[model samples]
Target: MTEHLTIVDHPLVQHKLTHMREKTTSTAGFRRLLREISNLLAYEVTRELPVTTREIETPMNTMQAPVLDGKKLVLVSILRAGNGLLDGVLELIPSARVGFVGLYRDEETLQPVQYYFKVPQELEDRLVIAVDPMLATGNSSVAAIDLLKKAGATNIRFMCLLAAPEGVARMKEAHPDVPIVTASLDERLNEDGYIVPGLGDAGDRMFGTK
Candidate 1:
């Protein structure tokens, strides 16, 4: 399976992303922009969700209304940073089942180590979307997806605010079938495993951490 990656270069997405990259952006402002971008990204991500018809009574007459098909969708957040995107997505997809995978990177090795994992049942039948803000090294993203697949999720998509080429290539090599969606694909990962020209650590900027 070929790995399909989507670049969401919508003008607004790019504009807000620019502000997000600036060092002077306040936490509140950064968060506000992320929420807006995530909502818009959610639109592109769910564009192809299967739909079914349900008969409903309108003000004047009865008509068949298009509704989402099958089981409610699942949104899996990859730990602390993922929560930022998760909150915005939940605002739009309120009915989506939420899950979390806690994976912290070993700074020296740039490898992912799992600490916690929890997800909704019947994942096999749901459209599982894993969310994380920055895909730097891809180890955490790949590890998170591996857990999802083990738990019976067959259809999975990954969404991120920004991605480095290293992370994208890593994900492609590991999971060729899972598609990726992101606002920007940055140049490369620095030796310290951070995206070049990235907005620092997403978890740090978002939560005011060091």
Candidate 2:
């Protein structure tokens, strides 16, 4: 993903996103849509992955089959909300390694505070994709990427269900090398730092916490 930001506007993605944004969608329904949409987004994110051919014998004949080059992917979920996207992506790349970064926002300051951190080994040798549901303030996403870099992740990508312009700009300024893939880039953040037109609190909606 060379582009700094890629918005997946596939008809299926947009259709499901509309259902997800509806306030009346049930927790079960919301969760289902997220998984489906994540599968599609994962396709877009991995579209440019390098591939090399290997000799393989098919039932009909021998042929060179294309396969991903390099180590299995490493997916690091920015805990809580990130878990929502994790399951769906894993379904697409089951062999990929998994990790977690737990950070909660300080309500008053709107800053991310690290509570837990763990990741797969050889991060620098493999591509690391960080999953988060909503990129509202960007503070949390930026901080999460910071930790990933410190842990030796040179190549990284950010994936989200929705993103705010503020969040995209923030990530670009902080980590321009890392690409962003999102379902929608909604309007500016509201007064409370939530995406104005975003599905309200992805984690809450998916988990039925609120």
Cα RMSD (Å) between model 1 and the true structure?
1.4
Q: List the residue pairs that clash in candidate 2.
A: none
Q: Write the per-residue lDDT of candidate 2 for residues 7-105, one digit (tens) a residue.
A: 999999999999999999999999999999999999988888788999999999999999999999899999998998999999999999999999998
Question: Please, what are the lDDT tens digits per residue for candidate 1 over residues 86-201?
Answer: 98899999999999999999999989999999999999999999999999999999999999999999999999999999999999999988999999999999989999988899
Predicted structure 2: clash tally = 0
Q: Could you tell me which 10 consecutive residues in candidate 2 have the lowest summed lDDT?
A: 42-51
Per-prediction backbone clash count: 0, 0
lDDT, candidate 2, residue 83?
92
lDDT of 2 at 54: 100
Candidate 1 residue runs with Cα over 4 Å from true position: 1-3
Q: By TM-score, how accurate is candidate 2?
A: 0.98
Give the lDDT of residue 26 in candidate 1.
91
Model 2 misplacement above 4 A: none
